[model samples]
Target: MPDSHSLRIVHCFRAPVGGIFRHVRDLIDAQVAAGHKVGIICDASSGGDFEESMLGEMRGKLELGLERIAMQRQIGPGDAVAAIRTYKIIKKSRPDVLHGHGAKGGTYARLFGSLLRASGSRVARFYSPHGGSLHFDLATLQGRFIFCVERLMERMTDRIIFVSKFEQGVYARKVGEPRCGHALIYNGLANREFEPVTPGPDAADFLFIGEMRALKGPDIFIDALTRGSAMSGRALTAVMVGDGIDRNHLIEQAQAGQMSGNIRFLMPMKAREAFRLAKVVVIPSRAEALPYIVLEALAAGRPVIASQIGGIPEILGEASPALVKPEAESLSGGMVTAINDLEGFQQLLPGTQVLRQKFSVENMAMRLEAEYFAALGR
Candidate 1:
C-alpha cells in the first residue's frame, strides 16, 4: 500500500516531444530522486529518433514503467480505443496521483482517474494545459467543443497546474475559471543548463529552433532572415533546427525566398548544442505556454529575440528590446537591430542570478511535490 510519504505518480501526455516532454522528464527525475515511484504514458507515433533515445534513457528510471500507445493529434473514432487501453495500463499501475500534461493526456488522466475513484482508489487527478487546445481560436467550432470538454473535465481534476500566468488567464477566459485547485509554476532549468554555451567560430548570425509548423513561425523566421538581410544591406545566415509536419513546406519556403544559400536546416538536437551553432536565438512562436527553449537559451547565455506572445514577456520582461510582435516585419526588424549591436542586445536580457533563483528545477520539483501532498490532504 502507498503511504503519504511516497506516492505512485503517473504522468500522461500525447506527444513525447518539445516542452511538454522536457517538463515531464524534469518532474520524473526530481520525483524519482525524492523517493516516489514514477511512470509515463505518451504517444507511440509522435516522436523521432531523438525522442526515442530520450525515452530509452528514461525507461530504466521509471518505477511504474513507461507505456506508449498510438495517440492521434486530432479527435477521432480511435480515441475510444486509445482511452480504454490507456485506462487499463493506468489501472495496472495503481497510481496514487494521475498527472496529465497537454490536452489528450489531461482528458485521459482526469476521466480515467475519476473512474478509478469510483472503484475505491484514492487517486488525485492533475492537469496542466501547456497551451495545447487553448491555442485554437475560441470563435471556431473546434475551439468551442474543446473548451466545453475542458470545462467538464475541471470537475474531475483535483488540481490544475498552469506553467504561466498567461496560460492561466487564457484558460479563465476561454474555458471559464477553473473550479478546482490550481497553481502557476514556471518551467525551470537544471543547474548544468545554466552554464553558458559559447558560440562556435563558424556559428551563424541567428538560430530558429522548434517545430516546423506555421504556428511555431518557421516560415516567419525564414521571411525575417530575408528581410533582415535586406535591411542590413547584406545576406544574413541562420540555422533552422527541428523536425515537424511542415518541415518540407518550410524548406520550400526558404528556397522560394532565395534563403536556401544562407539557411541551414538540421534535425532536432540538444538545445545547448544548437545554441552553440548560432550567435542569437529566435523564438517566433505565435502561441506557447512558457516554452522551455526561451529558458534554455537564456540559461545558456544566448541572446534571444522572441515574439511578445504567450508567457514570453513574463520571461524576457515586457520592456526588453528583444520582444517583438509575431510577424515577419517585426521579427526582421528585431533581427536587424541585434545584428547591428549584438552585445548591447545581449545585455538587455534578464540577469543570470534572477533566472537561477526563480527558474531552478530544484525549486520547481519541491513546489510540485508539496502541491501533490496538499491535494492528497497529507
Candidate 2:
C-alpha cells in the first residue's frame, strides 16, 4: 500500500518526556518531511500537561497515527499485559522499522519486532539506550541483572544506536561487545535553535533547568548556589526551572540552607525561554548521555558550567575550563569565576558555527534514515 521509496516507521518509548521525547519529535518531523509514514507508541500515564500539549501538536502529522498505552517505569507483573497490548498496536501499524528509545521501549520493540519476524513479517528492530539502564553500576546486584538482560536482548536487536562514544563504551563494559550492528549518533538541534537569545535586564545570575532529581543533581545546584553566594560575599540570585519527584525536597533543602529568598523555583518551560531568564546556565548533572540542553545553551550563545561526566566532556572539549566535577565545591568555584569574569568565560564556550556544523538536525536525520534503509537491505 505504500510507495517503494517511503518506509513505515514506528517509534516506541516509555516516558514521552525529556531527551528521548525531544529526539523522537525531531526524527518524526524530518521523516514526515521526507515523505515517510511515521507513528509513535509510548506510555500514556507518564507525562504531564506540557507533554500532552506537545503530543497534541504532533497528532495530525503522523500517517500511521499515535498510540499511547499504560506502560510502567519499573519491571513488574503488569508488563506482560502491557507488552501484549503494545504488540497488538505494532501489528496494526504494520511498521517496517520498529525503533525503540530507552530501556523499556527497547525491550518492547526488540521483543515484539522479533515476534513479528517469527510470524513471517519483515521488520527491522533498533534500540537507543538514551542513558537508561546503562547508568546502573556493575558493582550492584541490580546492575548485574540489568546487564544480563541487555546481553540477551542483543539477539533480538538489528541495530543499537548510541548517542555518544561514552555511552557505547559503557555498554561494552557492562553488557559486553554488541553481537549486532551499532552506531554512534549525537543528538542535534534545529536551525531556528541556533539563533542567539538575549538575556533580559532582570535575568538572574545563574539558572538550573532540567528534572530536579539526584541523578540530575538539582541538590548540587542548590548547594553550589549557596556556597557561591557565600564566597562572593553577596547574595547570588538564581532561578531553578523544572519539576520532578525531588522538587519539594530540593526546595526544602534550599530553605534549610537559608537560600529560600534568593532562588526562584518554576515549572518546566521551553529551553530558549528559560535561557533568557539567566545570565549563565548551570548543568551540574551527576550523569548524562550527551544532554540536548548543553547543545541548546551553546547554540543560543549562553555561557554554561557543566559536570565533566558522561559525554559532556566530548561536547565541551576535554580541555574546556567550563568542565567541573559534579561536586558543590567545584561547581561553586566555577560559578564564582563565571560571575566575576562573564565576558571571558562566555568566550571559552564553543562557537555557534562549530556547534551548528557538528550537531545539525538535518544531518542527524539523514544519517539515521540511511541506516534504516541499510538495515532493511534496500
Candidate 3:
C-alpha cells in the first residue's frame, strides 16, 4: 500500500453547487480529520459570494487545504482551457491520486491523467460522477452527443464511482458490460444536520428544495400539489426553494394554478433552513441519480414522496413503496396516497437511518482512500 502518510489527493470538479459540491466538501473534511492532505479544485464563480462561506464551513468542519480553479465556462473551448490549467496544477502539486467529480472535472482529470501516465508520472486516477452530463435528462440530440463523449472518456478512467447503484447500472450499460473499475458509493446525508430541532411548518406547509429546472420537475411538483389539495380537501402551502433557468416558467405555472398565496417563491436555502420550515419535503424530479435533498428530508424526520427514477429506489429500498411515476398525473396520485397514509409514511421514517449509514463521510472517504491505494497496484 502507498504510505498513507505520504498520499496527497486533489478533488477536481466543475463549478461548485448542488450535491457534488457538498460531497466534495464533506469528503475533504473527513480526509483532513484522518490526517490526509486534501485540496478542492473548482470554478469559484458559480455561487457568487458563498465561496467564503463554503470555505469557512469546510475549515470549521476539518483542517485542510483548498484551491479554487478558475472556471471560464461550463462547456466547449473553455472546458479545454480549464483542462490545461488543471494539468498544470496536477503537475505542480503531483498528488498521489487525482480524483474528479462531474463532467468537466472528469474529462479534465482523464486527459491530464493520460498525459501523466504517458510521461511516467506515478499518479493514480479516480472519477466520481456526482451525476455527470450523461446522467442528466437528455431526450434530444445534445444528450446523444453527451452519451458518446461519456463512452469515449470511460476508456481513460482507472475507476468510475457512482453515487447510486442505478447510475452505475445505466452507465455500465452505456459504456458496455466489460467496463471495469466501477464502484457504488451512495451519497450520504448529514443526519445530525437534519434532525428535527424546531417545530416544523404548519400542517399545510410543504417544501421543494432544489434547482428550479424542468428536469427537477418543478411544474410536475406543483401539479401534484394541486391534485393532492383537491383530493384531500385541504389547502396545501408550499415554499419553492431554489433558482434556475426554469424559475420564471415555474412561477407562471404556480400563478396559473392560483397557488401564489399558499405557495411562496423563496430563494434557495441551506439544509437547516430547508428542514426547519418543512412539514413534508417533496422531490418531484423527472430524473435523479440519488438526490441528497430527499435523503436530507428523511434525516430531518419528514416524509419525502419522490418519483421512482434513477437511484431513488435504492434509497427507499424495498420497505417503502413510495416511488411514483415521473408524470404529473402519476405523481399527483402518489402525493395523494402519501397524504392519506400518514401513519405508513411515519413508520418509514426510522428506516431512513438504515440507508443513512451508507452515506457517511467517513465511510465514503475510507472507501475512496482504499480505491486510491488500489489504483497504485498496492
lDDT of each: 0.93, 0.94, 0.73
What would the TM-scores of all predictions be? 0.98, 0.98, 0.88
lDDT by residue (tens digit), candidate 3, 16-58: 7777877887777667667677766778666644446776676
Measured by TM-score, how close is model 2 to the native structure?
0.98
> Which tens-of-lDDT digit does each residue in 78-148 have in candidate 2?
89889999999999999999999999999999999999999999999999999999999999999999999
What lDDT does candidate 3 reach at residue 172?
A: 62
Candidate 2: C-alpha RMSD to true structure equals 1.2
* Candidate 3 lDDT (Cα, 0 to 1): 0.73
Cα RMSD to native, each candidate?
1.3, 1.2, 2.9
Tens-place lDDT per residue, model 1, 37-96, is: 999999989989999999999999999999999999988998989999999999999999
TM-score-better candidate, 2 vs 3: 2
